[model samples]
Target: MKITGDHQLIKKINKYLVLDTIRRQFPISRADISARTGLNKATVSALVNELIESSFASETGLGESSGGRKPVMLLFNERAGFAIGVDLGVNYMLAMITDLSGAVVKKKRIDIAELEAGALTDKLKKTIRGLMPHVPASPYGVIGIGIGVPGLVDDQGSVLSAPNLGWTDVPLQSILAEEFGVDVVIDNEANAGALGEKEFGAGRDVSNLLYISVGMGIGAGIILNDTLYRGFSGFSGEVGHMALAQDGPLCGCGNRGCWETFASEKALLVNARAAYDDAADADAAAPNLDTLLSLARQGDPEARRLFADTGRWLGTGIANLVNVFNPELIVIGNRMSLASAWIGEAVYETLDSRSLAFHRSRASVAYSQLGHSSAALGAASMAIQRFFSTMKATWE
Candidate 1:
């Protein structure tokens, strides 16, 4: 059909409505899609045919019919394309390749001591290249790459500052895009984590949610009314640097008593190290988080106390979030969530005491459903979203 103007817009909208309905309710029949989307049967059929021809959908056998001929069911072709997602942490990098449906087809994690921008970029390139060999050929093979970084990322995907990695004003997105010859997206790790949870994890059914990433540092991804609330300049959700204590410990962000300085995995480790240093066997090597968790599990009083203290601090920060945002759900993610047993109690206790009664009563705190994979998966999901949006525009 030679569509134009308002008719073309309507056709495009109806096409995507049918596609989305099939994606969500597949294996759904054309009649079902038409009914769900309120589009005419002929329009739904035409869109489905186009999607199938474009490899974005498929006929998935027959479904039960309400009398009359058996209806052919339609399914979204999740394997039509792939996306790469990378989560760059201070001490580690996680990379994954996901299909259009956000299923991780392959993934890898690499630990690194290097923090120089060049070194990190090289490492990322190498990792992505390794995954490329495994990507199956499709209509849009490796549509794009999305990266989640532990730093302040501007709209142009520049890392303005990442104190933990000593990176500043690095054009990470452009660098990767140039290397791979594909679109590249970069955002704060917490924001990616929030998107991950909202689309595929704990916050799947909740519109208003908070994803708190408590790792070497703390950051939050705010979801208000089912959308990521990136402020102007895309530098929102740097809640870790929010000052909580005027005379508290120094933070890497050149701030005193930042929330992360008290509630982060770094704080937990510091407290654990302090406890071990004061022990009778002071010569023992400082314990890592896993070691501390083992000690806490084995009923080490000092280790348990440290986790509880960290949890209390975490709760204080969460209380502030609850009062301010009143999110329906708050997801506590990253490495610290592994020690939920020791930390959860103190978190609840502190939150109960600190948060406003109304807000505290409404907001339920939970651990990340995707655990350590949230950021990486979120990046892949974002890439997939971008790809579909572009595809919809082309149809329009």
Candidate 2:
């Protein structure tokens, strides 16, 4: 009986290692796990069997042979648990459900005009309840939830003045954890966007990069030496509020001439409205930015000019970022990249004029490949990474 119990404990330890290996590098074979982890083939096979029995992993058919019998592949059982990623935007909330491999199985967009703490919490609870029907059930249960709120979230997940959301001192993490009965992580949206780009998008391979998310407001996610650089008080990447133009437009953050006031989607929309209101066309009084984008796409000279000006402002910001950090890449995200052709030229123009040649030569700017979905995608990746990290920590 003592020997049997010891064997069971050893089996459990090895099984967890197998499951973790599969979670980190899925679509792998037992032999590959053995080779990478330096575990004997017999032990790997036995641990894989336990994981399969516990529904933590599923066997794939086969891999290419190398002068031996074909190896059976394995992947994490994505259906074993569900994770939710919420992008709490100034104008809307985007909630997405993704599996273990970061594939979005379902998504919902909720319109939010006012961001009263109580009302927003109620809405979030309802949104999660509404999404419960879509979640897949398995052994480990829904591991955790991640939220990307557009503000300075402290380490404990308290909101510190999300000006656009009208939030202050909101215990967002605790509230969500109580409601969901799971772990919750809340972070700045731009930081989340940076994490997303590094893990699954543009900065996957680059050691140093900046992901600039120009949404309703401008924000940046900085990755230096391949890690998210959240400085003191988790507010390092709040570069949007940096002073750019003296005595320019006042920002909602109670600042004058903030970079976001000149470079954000809100800025573009505000400028478009001003331009439209003064246009010769009488039908230009509509309050839709998408319409403005469409008009610009159709060769409206005024709209094109507005986008170019916005792009230049964005490029100026990028030049400053490059001058400071000297990253290898800069990813322009949100709807800002919608006008990439125009913005690309403006970005190059500013870089050519202002940035030092050495810094300019090192950085290559590009539009976010994932486009507007970068934040929510990053939130999903956050959930997965947190889960694996927690598992590894526990094992250690």
* Number of the top lDDT candidate: 1
Estimate every model's Cα lDDT from 0 to 1.
0.90, 0.83
Candidate 2 per-residue lDDT over residues 201-250, each given as its tens digit: 88888999999988888889999998899887678888889999889899
List ranges where model 2 is wrong by over 4 Å. 1-21, 38-50, 393-396
State the displacement of the C-alpha of residue 378, model 2, in Å, after optimal TM-score superposition: 1.1
Residues 180-280, model 1: lDDT tens digits: 99888899999999999998899999999999999999999999998999888778899999999999999999989999999998887787777788789
Highest TM-score among the candidates is held by which one? 1
Q: What is the Cα root-mean-square deviation between model 1 and the actual structure?
A: 1.7
Error of 2 at 285 (Å): 3.4
